[model samples]
Target: MHGCFWHRHPGCPKATTPATRPEWWQRKFDGNVERDRQQMDRLIAAGWRVGIVWECALGRKADGALIDRVEAFIRHGRDLRAEWP
Candidate 1:
């Protein structure tokens, strides 16, 4: 999920909601999170393992580590939900 500020990414500096029409942004973010929740539930019901690789993980210093983490997730089959280091 290549989400933007719409998903309300926790602790990410880039995930700030729009300033204009704060109420509308809140409603939109609420809907976005709800949709993500429903989709995640369906995927879990289907026995699919899900992982969230945040966009912040793709940067100059962290990109290499992020790739390694992704490879480990695929190869080792471990449940992981990593955040900013």
Candidate 2:
């Protein structure tokens, strides 16, 4: 299931962001990104699908439906790669 069960605490050391008192926003953010990468790596290695649901996507805006995006990713992720023009 692509590490889908490996949920972390959003901002914890393993997930949650550092509390205001710690004042380690940048470090925590970087760590979070890195951990996400590692999770992807492990998932890929295990031959599973990985779908990342960003926090901001939950709200209505330019991105639109979170479910739609996730569905599209799941349906097309394997055959997809970034293209820059």
Compare the candidates by TM-score and give the number of the best one: 1
Off by over 4 Å in 1: 60-62, 80-85
Candidate 2, residues 1-85: lDDT per residue as tens digits?
1121234334323334445755567565566568877877787788777665544334356444555666677777673321110
Q: Where does candidate 2 have its weakest 10-residue lDDT segment?
A: 1-10
Report the C-alpha displacement of residue 13, candidate 1, in angstroms.
1.2
TM-score of each: 0.80, 0.49
**Model 1 clash pairs?**
none
Cα RMSD (angstroms) for every candidate in the order listed? 2.5, 7.9
In model 2, the clashing pairs are: 10-15, 11-15, 11-16, 11-17, 12-15, 12-16
Any idea what lDDT model 2 has? 0.51
